[model samples]
Target: MKVEIHNVFKNMRYKFFQTEDGIYYIVEIKPSFWKTLFPFLYWFFPFPVYKVEDEKTIEGIQTPESWSFDKSSAVLATGGVAVFIATIFRGKIEMFKTELPLYIKIIFLIVMIFCVFLIRLFVNKVKFHDLYKHVNLKQLERFEIKVKPQSFKHIGQMFASYIFFLFFSVMSYIMFFLDGNVFVLIGGAAMLIMFSLVVNITVKEGLTKIEFIK
Candidate 1:
C-alpha cells in the first residue's frame, strides 16, 4: 500500500483536507459551531466585513467615480430638476386644508436646497477628464457599477438627501390636501408602504445592473 501527499495550489477550485498518515482520506473540514454562526454574528455585530476584490478585478470595475462625464453630469442635472419640481409643488399650498407651519415649510425648503447644494459639491469633485483617462475605457465603453450589499446602507444614506426632498414633499402635499380625505391618506400611505417594500427587497438582494448611456 502506498500513501501520497499532494500540496495544495492557488489554482485549485476546491480545497480538500486529509486525515491519518497512512490513509489520505479526502475530507471536507466542516466549520466549527462558532464558524457556522459567523454569518449571523457578523451581520448582527458591529464588526465590519471588507470584501477585498483582487487587483485585477478591481481594475476592471468602473464605479460612478469612473463613469464618463456625460453620465456623471446627470446627477447634478437631476438635482436641479428636483429643485424646480419642489418649487412648482409648493406653489399650490393654498389648495391644502391646512398648510404646513411656516417654519416647517421653511425647513423643508432649506433641506431640499441643501440637497441640491451637496449634489453640486459632489459633481464639482468629479474630474470630467476621468472619462478619457482610464486605460480600460475601450472595454468600459459601457460597464455596470455595482453597489455591494454591505455598502447599500451607505448608498441609501447618499440617496436619502434626494429621497427626503422628494418623499417629504409628496407627504407635504398629502398633509395639505388629503387631510380631509381619509381614503386618500390611507391609499397614499399604502402606496408608500409598497414602494418601501420594493426598495428594501432590492437592497437585500443587492443591485447589479448593466450600464448604458443615452
Candidate 2:
C-alpha cells in the first residue's frame, strides 16, 4: 500500500506493503525534492525501516501535542537558527574581519550547513511509533500482520562517512595544534564525535548482517 508522506514542502509518497510471512516493509518511493537537492541538510539522519513487534492494531495517526518554546527541542531549534544566521552574516561582522584560509572557510561552510539541518532535526516532531496508522485497523485481516525487520541499505554510505571523517578529524587536530585555530579544533571535535558514532553503528550493522546470514 502507498501512504502520503507528511511533508511540509511538497507531496511525496512512501510505500508500505506486506509479505507472505506476515512481514511489512516501508520504503521510500519518491524522496523529497528539497532533500535531494540539499543532501547535506539531512546527513547522517536515520530513516530506518521499523520493526513493529506489538500485535496491537492502530487507527489513523493522532496529532502530536503543540510545540512550546519552553521545551528543549524548541531551544535547540532556536539555537541552530541563530547559529546559521550568524554564519551567513559572519563576513559583515567586525570581529571576523580577518579572512580565513580556504580550507577553514570550507569547514565553516560545512558546519553552517549542519546548523541548518540541526534546526530541521529538532523542529521535526514526528512520532514513528504512531506510524502504525498506515495499517488500517478497520480492516480485520490486517490485524494479524506483524512487521518484521528488513536488511540495511545504507551501510556503504556509513562506512564512507567513517573514512572521510576519520581523515578530517585527524587533520583538524594537527592543524589546530600547529596554527592554534580554535574554530578548527571545534570542528575537529564535532567530526571526531560523529566519526566515533559511525564506527560504532557500522560495527553493529555488520554484526547484524552476520546474524541475519546465520
Candidate 3:
C-alpha cells in the first residue's frame, strides 16, 4: 500500500493517506501516557474502550467508541485535578475524627507547589505551535487539517494549575483550623509525586515525537 503519514501533534490528529487503495484513514494515536495507562487500567478492570477517529466522530458516536478525553495532555490534566480534589476532601473528612498539625501541612503545601511548577514547565514544553513546522505530508496526498485548535485553548491549562493551588490553599486552611495529620500529608505528597511523573512522561513523549519529525 502506498502510504503517507502526517504528524499532526497540534491538532492531535494523525492523517494517513494510502494511494494504492485510493483511501485515506485518520488514525488517532493517544498521547504516550494515555496510551500506556489506559490499556493497563483496561487490562485490570476490563472496561469498555472508546476512541475518536476525528473531531466530528467524537461528538456523534454512541457506545464504547463515542466517549473520549481530548488528548494525552488533557487526560493528565484531569488526573491532576482529581488528585488535588480527592486529597483535600479525604483530608477534611479525616480531620473531623483526628486533629492534624501545622508543620506537616506546610511540608505538603511546599511539595504540591513544586509539583505544580513542574507540570507548568511540562505544559510549556508541549506547545502545539512547535509541531506545526515539523509535520510531513507527501506531495500527492489529499489531506485536510481536521482538528484545528484555537490559540486560547491553552487557557484550560489553568484548570490543572489552579487545582494544585487550591489543594495548597485547602491544606493551609486546615492547618490553621486543626493540626496537620500524617496521613493527609503523606497522601498529598504521593499525589504530587504522581502528578510530576505523569506530566514529565507526557511532555517527554511529545518532545520525542517532534524530534523524530525534525
Candidate 4:
C-alpha cells in the first residue's frame, strides 16, 4: 500500500493517508487504550492499533505487515518467558537447535521476510526514546516528553502479532522439550531481538538505536 504522511504532531502521533484503488484511508496511530488507562504500561508493552477515520473498530488485521513491531516484540517476550521456564528446570542451552516442523518452518520463513521488510520500511518510521537537539534542558533535570514517537501502523500490528504467536505456540506446544532448556529459550530470544536491532541500524538511515522497533 502506498501512503503519504499527512500530519505529524508532537510525540510523533498523527494521521497518515493511504490511497488504494481511488479509496482514501486515514490511518491513526496513537497511544493504546490500555496505555491511556495505565500510562506507565507504554514503557513495557505499548499496544497500538490502526483505525479508519471516524470508525470505532480497529482494522489492524487488514494490513498485517504494518504491524511488524508487534511481531518482533512478541518474539522477544516469548523468548523471555521461555527463558524463565528453562531457568526453573535448570536447563543449559543458549539456543534451540531442534528440527523445525514443516508449518513452523513456513512461519519462520515468513518471519524472515517480515524482518527484512521491517528494516526497510517500518522500523525507520519508529521514533522511540527520541532526543530533540533544540529542546532546552535544565541542568541535572530529567528530560520529559509526553507523547511517544510511534508510527501510525503500530496499533494494528500489535494485535496481529499476538494472534500469530499464540497460534505458533499452541501448534508446537512450544516444541515440547523447550520446557527444559532455559538458556536456549532466553538466548534465542535475545538473538532474535538483537538481529532485528542490527537490521534497524544497518537498513534504517539517520540515527541508530536499539529501542522500540515500531
Most TM-score-accurate candidate:
2
Candidate with maximal lDDT? 2
The residue pairs in collision within model 3 are 100-179, 100-180, 100-181, 101-179, 101-180
**On residues 155-187, what C-alpha lDDT tens digit does candidate 2 reach at each position?**
466547767887897788677545656566666
List residue ranges in candidate 1 displaced over 4 A: 1-72, 89-91, 96-148, 152-194, 197-214
Compose the digit string of candidate 3's lDDT tens values, residues 18-90. 2343443333333344533222221122111122233433222212444444688888998999799887776
TM-score of 4: 0.23
lDDT of 1 at 76: 88
Error of 2 at 90 (Å): 6.1
Error at 213, model 3, angstroms: 33
Q: Which stretches of candidate 4 lie over 4 Å from their true place?
A: 1-129, 134-158, 166-179, 187-214
Full-model lDDT for every candidate: 0.34, 0.42, 0.39, 0.36
> Which pairs of residues clash in candidate 2, taking residues 3 or more apart in a chain or in different chains?
none
Q: Rank the candidates by lDDT, best first.
A: 2, 3, 4, 1
For residues 15-90, write the lDDT of model 4, one tens digit per residue: 3233344332322233333433233344354222232332221132122343334678888998999788767756
C-alpha TM-scores of all predictions = 0.25, 0.32, 0.27, 0.23
Pick out the ten consecutive residues of candidate 3 with the lowest summed lDDT. 205-214
